[model samples]
Target: MIALHDAVGRLSAALGGSPAAKLAASALVEADALGLPRFGIAMLDEWAADAAPVPETAGAQAVSWLDCSSCFAPLAVAGTTLDLAGTARQSGIAAVFLRGVRGFGRLVPFVRHLADTGLVGIAGAEGPPFVAPHGGTRPVIGTNPFALAMGRGSERVVIDIASSSATMADIKTARMTDAPLPDGIALDGAGRPTRVAADVAALLPRGGQIGSLLGLTVELLAGVAGAGRGDAKGRGVFILAFDPAAAGEGIDWQGKLAALKSDWTDGGGYWPRGGALAAGTMLDGDFAQRLDTHLARMAGQAGC
Candidate 1:
């Protein structure tokens, strides 16, 4: 635990120093990097570019929201997302819309944090369009990521996904290395399928037509309806939360969940959310050396 905390401290130090507007966003993302290993991501550079996408100056305004049980609300660029959790505790459910901020990267830790606080968490977020609709020419919708988390005793089940065939950040890294992308991940500027990283201009949604619909739906729900950003400006977020106790009068939620788990075969799970957490997370020796070098160089540039 100390080792983990120390690593996170170093990383957060390296990622700190953003303008007021994006300061909250930068902190959230830096916290996010600490849990990458739990999901099998061993390299910090996975999301780092020439430099991490930290903010240098405040975007526009401070975050603010409205008071309602279940309503669409807008959040300022540096608005406190914790406000959403507070509203959920009061009303038992809330659907929050975030505006002027597009810093959402992964949904697991964010939602899990809410769940751990004794609320069921569900969220969807959309940013600038990088994923094109299936069979469409140019990119229209974002990757449209979504996440869900549930609290059970001391355990929290977390699930998150990007509707795109491939993650936008990974593609950016691939472009950095001039490496080829996986088949069917991205299309060229001319709307033609191509694996060459440098040629990638738009990404494809997962599952062809179906995934495209999900992606578009999230864009509408989060980007347009939630944040009221019809042009898909900045990051748009939609989050909902409800208390399980208030939801069910006397249901044995944990018992039922345990029974369901017993019915399933042992070791059966899905990616990202699935997988043995007890499993040791390690990178290849050569890759580890490279990562250390990269971190040292970044730390120096960060002036930490």
Candidate 2:
């Protein structure tokens, strides 16, 4: 398994990043090291694609208070990710509309942090239009990813997903495995179905037509809602945090959720980390080697 510190050092040196960037990068690598993620690729591509731009602070116009707050941040997503959690702590429920942000990375880690801070998080983001439309060939909408996380006593559960049938990262990873695509996962450059990952040019939607609908819906919520002035920079995410105690359920609300989870498991079975832990992470040598080479290249570019 890749040590978390090593991953952080490599990513930080590669990006010349902030603490938040380093933390997010480390999580991305760890997730990939564990397995091919159901969500997508690590944020390293976004970071290494270009040197990080100077962050644009959220001016007063950034905050718009209605039932919650919306922040238009044309900058990094990490600080705002934490800021929303704190806002929830004070506001009972807070929404952060992060516009023009990049390197959204993994939602699980972000929401897990919010959960640890005693909050429930709902988040989504829009990235470059890498997926072709449901009935069309050319790319149009983003993968449209979302995540939900909640705290349960001393435990936390995070669920993350991308609306595409398979993410761009999935195709790239599949290339490494030399595996054929599933029945309806991707389309080739010629707009025909292809099983070979390397030949695939665009991804299809998840759940067939349903994923198509949901993908657009996600963009509406996370992308259009907090529409930014500039580019997505490969990542534009929005997150909302809610304080469960705001419902006047008291501090034991997490206990209630945890108990419900136990009941669900007792009834039959559920895939959650309530009392169990994952089998130890088994690092893939090829993945680690390729990842290291890419990071080393970025670091060299950064003069690290």
Candidate 3:
């Protein structure tokens, strides 16, 4: 196991000392800590090399639109979502329609950041077409994921899931480890079911038509966010945040939440949340070695 701070420091050094680098480093480490290592520091160089795009912002009422011109920097995407927490606080509710970006990692961290601020956050993203519609062959939809976070501080609930049976990152990790995917998770170019991750041309939706419907929902939401027709090289992201205190529920929401927690616990259900790694968290030997090798290569390239 590799210490969290050690991983962050190495990633930061490899990416440089820019503020954006630090943000990406921290988010990537959080990904590993949250048990989503497929989206973690493994792709540090890929993320760091992608420059942040400039978005044309258009704001009206409690909503805003950010039309980025090209590919996204993970840093800019996360930074923008963090900025929206303040907007939600002021407006009680706020939303942003994002388009013309790609390669942002997991949506969990973004919404989790909002939930930490005592706001309810909802986010969905449509990625490159990597999944097929129900009962159809060929790629037509992304491994779209939706995420929602609610509650305050340590007491929170978070839901983040992809509509596809498997995510692109999962495939990448499978390939990296030379591991075969579970049966029925993906299809080859001819749309036949296959377990070999390397031959995966597209993914199957979770629960057949039901998950297809969710993917359709994400696509339509992206369309509403101003994405264009045809193959989507970039991605569309939807983010909405609201201050729960503004809901006019006429009750102590936090206290009620605590009561609900008690009941949930008594029922053997635990609160669902993602968090930073414990101080003792460490990376395994293989991943730690990978990090060291990548960092050394980067340093050598820079003649350091």
Candidate 4:
């Protein structure tokens, strides 16, 4: 296992000491600690490319937007979410939209952060086309991930799911390990069911029509938010947060939720809760080797 501190230092060195680099490095580590390695250090190269040419931002009041065509998505999204958390606390609810951004890894960490602060959080993003629409063979929708988290304190229900039958990360990971893809989740270039990850042309939508609609919803949200941007490719994301304290004495949400958790657990059902980031965690040996290779490659390129 690679030490957590060692991993962070390597990533930071490869990324340089910019503020964005620091954030991205920390986020990747956090993702791994949360057991979401798909969004972890494996994406260092992608994040490095997106971390440049800082994004343009514009907003006022409860609604704001970001133009992240050439920006580091993790940094942009994280900064925006943090800002909106404060807004939601003061105004009950707040939302921010981002367009032209690339993959920003998992949304769980961001929403879970809000949940930790006693706010209900929701986030969704549409990426490059990889999933087919309902009853269609052609790839037309992104994985279109959606995540939500809500609870009083440490006991929060967090859900993060791809609207598609599978995520691009799943395909990439399978290909890396030379493993067969799961049946029924993906199609080949000819749109035929395929088990070979290398042949994957498109993923099926999750839950059939329901997942298709969810992907479509993300597309529309991103479309409207990035309406005027020439670089907009319908790749957009939005984060929303709501503070219960702004309710001014309504239902006891905290108490009700606590009771619900008890009832569900007592019935032998596990809660879909978020886990805290384990800062002292270690990475799998294979994954750590891969990261070291990436760092070495980057360093060699820098010397060229």
Candidate 5:
């Protein structure tokens, strides 16, 4: 098991001190622990190597323009921007947009960082085209994703979700592991429903219209804010942060949100197989304990 701090250290070095690299590592490691193939070991080497590559020019910053000529340079710059935004929020109003960057691996970890710091954060990204807009099978939209983080006293809640029903990475991972594709997630090379991951040629929106709408919203927010469109060549990201304490009702808001979450879980029911006695579950006794051990081991492997 790898402790979170140690994992962060190795990943930070591997990705050349970029925030995006750390976020990708966290996602991969966390997904590995959850037995999810898409965000697991398959990503480790590429992520590490991607971080270490030298850029032709160092990233530059201005009050209104942030420029990184090399694609990979933006990862470190994005991390720095997030740190600054988080720090600024400590003083008063806490919201800022980071634009003109590229090569962000995923959006989750950035928001997770804000949650860890006792603040709320949201991140949106527009990238290469992969999915089609509503009512169209042709690929015209990128698999944009929006991530959110909320702090609840000593604990934090994190959610990273794609506007599409499934991310292209998931399909690729499923192909790598020979896992069955989830229903309604993808289309075959011939643009037909296909369960074979290897046969998948493209991804589909999660709930058709609803998913497409969500994807559109994310693209507009990220793309229109000087971030390129989802189908555009370059990638862009927008980050927002908030300090609930600044609202003068942090505790109250937390309590209410917690209650709503509890109620929702109670009414909606637990996940499928949640109560089943599986081999993995039996071996670990509990998920949290198993995760702690796994993290520790990963940390050791990374020489952290």
Candidate 6:
């Protein structure tokens, strides 16, 4: 993990401290920690190979406009605004807009950064319209996503979701791994529901019009800030952060939430799909012993 952080740092140095690069690196590491194979080890080689120069603009306030220069500026501006909001928690509410940027790899890291700072964070990004509204055959709106992060006890709870039934990257990853995708995610080129990842021509909304409403809400949050339209022209991102203490009286909010969670779990509930697996549970002791025994063989394979 330390080596991975160092590698990401080196990449960021080449990108002129752009927030997009830093957030991407952090998201990659967090995904690795969560053992998500597609977003974890598989991406390291791609990141290393895709170290092309990313153009950036002069630094400005959160409400200021930025010239992305056809780079991943939406994420960069979002990161900067998130960092500013973290500091602004000392005051009251902190809302910022990041405009005139384009392209964003993944947006979860910006929300996670605010959560890591002991603040509740919500971020929304509006990109090209890639998905059609439910019951429609043609593309009508972007697969705009909203990400929320809040400090939960010593750990953080991060939820990144797209109003669409699935993200384009999710479909692509399912295709690459030959994995069965969740139902109601995509449609065939002929506008019929399909399971084959390759046949996915457009995405579906999360819960029909309700999801569309949420998508529009995200659009408005990302739009009115003077950012570009949600069409294919340019992209925009809006971020908001607030400290929990700012709302309630002086109390250990984390502890209270943890207690509530404990009570709810003890009360019993349906098992989540895939069963509950604690962190690091996949690395069994027997597997670790075998891995140690085969260290020499692993080294030889590396040389080969």
Give the best candidate by lDDT: 4
Q: What are the clash counts of all predictions, listed in order?
A: 3, 2, 4, 0, 12, 0
lDDT of 2 by residue, 1-304 (tens): 4554565566655554765556456556556655634321344544444444434336422233211112212224556666666667887787766555655446666776677777887777777887777887876778887788887443466677778988787788899999888978888899888899999888888877788887777787766776731253334567788888787855687777878777877899653531212335445666667668767766665664
- Candidate 6 residue lDDT tens string, 143-189: 88888877643335666778898878788988998887778877888
Q: Can you write out model 4's per-residue Cα lDDT over 1-304, one digit (the tens) per residue? A: 8887778777866777655456567777777766777788766565543245554345435777777766666666667777788888877898888887765777877887788788999988877788998888879868878889998454579987778988777898899999988778998888888999999999999998999999888767755564412344326888889988776677788888889889999999988865554557777887788788878877776666
TM-score of predicted model 6? 0.65
Query: TM-scores for all candidates?
Result: 0.66, 0.70, 0.77, 0.78, 0.65, 0.65
Instruction: Tell me how candidate 2 scores on lDDT.
Output: 0.64
Mind giving the per-residue lDDT tens digits that candidate 1 earns over 77-101? Answer: 2223455566677776765666444
CA lDDT, every model vs. true structure: 0.57, 0.64, 0.74, 0.76, 0.57, 0.60
Candidate 2 positional error at 6, Å: 6.7
| Comparison by TM-score, 4 against 5, better one | 4
Error of 2 at 97 (Å): 2.5
Residue ranges of candidate 1 with Cα displaced over 4 Å: 6-81, 153-155, 228-233, 265-267, 271-304
Cα deviation of 163, candidate 3, in Å? 0.5
Model 5 C-alpha lDDT per residue in residues 150-187, reported as the tens digit of each score: 76443346666677777777777787999898787777
Clashing pairs in 2: 165-205, 165-206
The residue-level lDDT of candidate 3 at 69 comes to 40
Candidate scoring better on TM-score of 1 and 2: 2
lDDT of 3: 0.74
Q: What is the lDDT of residue 117 in candidate 1?
A: 73
Model number with the top TM-score: 4
